[model samples]
Target: MGKKAEILERLGGIAPALRRYSRALCAGAGHTLSDELVQSALQSVGARIRARELRPADLQEARLEAYAALTASAGKRLTDASRPTPRHPPIVHGLAELSLDDRAALLLVSLEGMGYDAAARVLGIRREALLAQLMRARAKLGVVGLPPADAESGARRAASHLRIVK
Candidate 1:
């Protein structure tokens, strides 16, 4: 297969994981917030591809670019008031308190099972920077690994209430 085709295939495999991550990021499903973000990211990538700003060979870069687009538009998706109210476990509350990047890093690592190197690439940061972000996020959340207590389910429930109204 061609490079772009290959990249598209990769996107297919990772899309579900991205959706789960999105659910976690928006604090729980939020209408189709994650889908919207992924779609927006695709459009952004398409534009870049047309402009020759992104080469087919740069699939990883494209992934980063698309995710950055998703993240850039996250604030709007996170503020809708119509979504279901999520239950707040201590972890969810703690996650809510983190910066967007920190939350992304923590979720990507702990929840999504991404290695620091891969997560860092997705975040467009150096590995060391990703590690720091993870550490700070974990410290804030008060856990080293995924906590299986009320925090885990609470985070999911709380995330659902975040209505990404767009």
Candidate 2:
């Protein structure tokens, strides 16, 4: 395959993970907004790749780039003062309580299964800083000592009130 085709293929492979991460990032905003975020991120990444501004050596690098894009886009939206607040479950409200950095750190590491180095790179922070942010996020969410599965399940239960529309 040509270079562009290869890049497109790799992006397609990471789309599911990107969507999941975007949803977590959007939490209370619901799936529609999250899907839009994912689309924006993908477009931004694709444009950079095409312009030769971002050259991912492999799938992992591509995933990081995609994540960085999504995080940036989400940050802008979350910080927009004019945006109306949407009703969310208590769990989502808890997530919204976190600073953008903390939430991104927690989700990138916990939900996306990104390593400290990769997550740090995506957040444009040092590994130590990432750990600190993750700790704060966990503490805020009261999931400090809980296992990952338990924390995730709790979030799922809290979000269960949201009905999924086909």
Candidate 3:
């Protein structure tokens, strides 16, 4: 295969992982966001590959760059994914509790599966600072109500409804 084809193949291999990461990144929001984020990230990465801005030796770097691009894109919009969420807990609460930088830091590292160094690079911050932001974000997550036990039940119901729709 040609170099461009080879790179596309490699990116395709990583797409499922990217989707899982994106889902977790936008967890507690809406289902549509997971698809949107993954699509955006892949498109950004594909563009970079097509432009030859990323080399084979730098695939991981390219992935991180793509993730950063995705997050930056997210930062620009008022994207309310059309998926209707439960009214009781308020969809925006957990996210709103976080400072934007902290939320971005948490999502990139924890949900997007970007390593600390990679996430730090994406956020243009030192690893230590990124960790601190993540810590703060996690702490803030606890203040919200839903509680751990109820989350599973609620998730199951949501999953059942989602599956029915599908």
Candidate 4:
């Protein structure tokens, strides 16, 4: 495969995970914000590639960078009006109790099935820091499963119901 193709292939392999992670990063902000975050992150990655700042070999790093940057940016951009009452009230309640960093760590490792080191890289944190956040998240999650399967299905159903406006 050519360099561009090889890089895109690597990104494609993790596209679903990246989407999942992006939404979970700021779950309380509502799907609209989370979806936009993913779009922005993808555009950022493409921009970097076009600028020749990101080489094909840096796909994994780029993926991590994109996610981390978007998460941070989302924190700043999220507004009170944009905040939705957590749809799964109970689950969202539990997650709401944890810090954003903790939630991100927990979801990256448990929700996305990422290894501790990989999750840390994505968060731009040390493995030890990731472990601490993960531990905190796990404790909080005892009350709320990290990746609520039903929540995901509900999201998918909602997406299916969306109609394009002319």
Candidate 5:
């Protein structure tokens, strides 16, 4: 294949993961916005690749670059004052409550399954800072281990609200 075709192929391989990450990143913003973010990231990466500004040595490197681009795009969107707030699911609302840095840290590690070093590189932060962000994000999301009694009651209360529909 030609160089352009090869680049396209490489990008295609990582597109699914990018979509998933974008969805998680834009959780409360709706799928349309998430999809737009993915498209924007793809275009940015493509341009860089064509301009010889970003030359990935491997698929993993390419994926990280794409993620970094998407995260940057998400940050820009979050800072736009004219953007309207929309209602989202409880879990999405919880994610939206997090600061951009906290959300990016939490999602990159937990949702994208990136290592601390790789995720830190993507966020342009040190490993220690990344760990601190992860801790703060987890604490904010109430991801701590609850006591046995509280766990049982919390589980029961959560289960009580469940309904089965045919």
Candidate 6:
């Protein structure tokens, strides 16, 4: 097959993961938020591919690069975006409220499924700094939007299921 076909195939394979990351980025913020970011990211990736500016070593790299680009763009965008929407979960809302560096640091590690080293590389920060930022972000998230009392019992039930059988 042709190079274009190959690229298309690679993009198709990574689409689900991209969607997941985008969803995680804006989880509970609103359904369309992630979709918008994904579209914007895809547009950027397509342009780069057409310009031959980005070279993917393999399908996975292509996916990673695409994700990196999106995360970077979204990080920048989040700062200028408006106030917290009700649809946003407490955790996701807190993330959105953070500075781009902190938000990107946390999302790249947690939502993007990237390790500390990889996230640091993407954020251009030292690994230790990234970890510290992630810690602060998580702590801030915990303090925001405490869950309702009604959810506690459900959480306990879910926790109980994790008990291992000997």
Highest TM-score scorer: 2
lDDT of 4 by residue, 79-111 (tens): 545443745444455655667789788766656
Give Cα-based local distance difference scores for all models: 0.64, 0.74, 0.62, 0.65, 0.72, 0.63
How far residue 148's Cα lies from its native spot in candidate 2, in Å, is 8.2
lDDT of 5 by residue, 1-166 (tens): 8755586577877777888777767755666877888888888888888888888776677778889999999988864332325544454555666788987897888667789999999999999999999888767666523211246456554322111100
Lowest summed lDDT across 10 adjacent residues in model 5 is found at 157-166
Full candidate order by lDDT, most accurate first:
2, 5, 4, 1, 6, 3
Residue-wise lDDT of candidate 6 within 32-124, one digit each (tens)?
Answer: 766777777777776777688876656656666677777776666554555457854355566566666776676666555688887787666
The better candidate by TM-score, 3 or 5, is 5
Listed per model in order, the count of residue pairs whose N, CA or C atoms clash below 3 Å is 4, 0, 0, 0, 0, 2
Tens-digit lDDT track of model 2 for 1-166? 8766687677877778888777767766667777888888888988888888888876667778889999999988765342225554455565667788998998887677779999999999999999999888878776623322346556664334222211
TM-score between model 1 and native? 0.65
Q: Worst 10-residue stretch by lDDT in candidate 3?
A: 157-166
Please identify which of the two predictions, 1 or 4, would achieve the higher lDDT against the true structure: 4
Flag the better candidate by TM-score, 2 or 5.
2
Q: After best superposition, candidate 3 residue 124: deviation in angstroms?
A: 2.4
lDDT of 2 at 124: 96
Residue pairs of candidate 4 with colliding backbone atoms: none
Clashing pairs in 3: none
TM-score, candidate 4, is: 0.72
TM-score, each model?
A: 0.65, 0.78, 0.66, 0.72, 0.77, 0.69
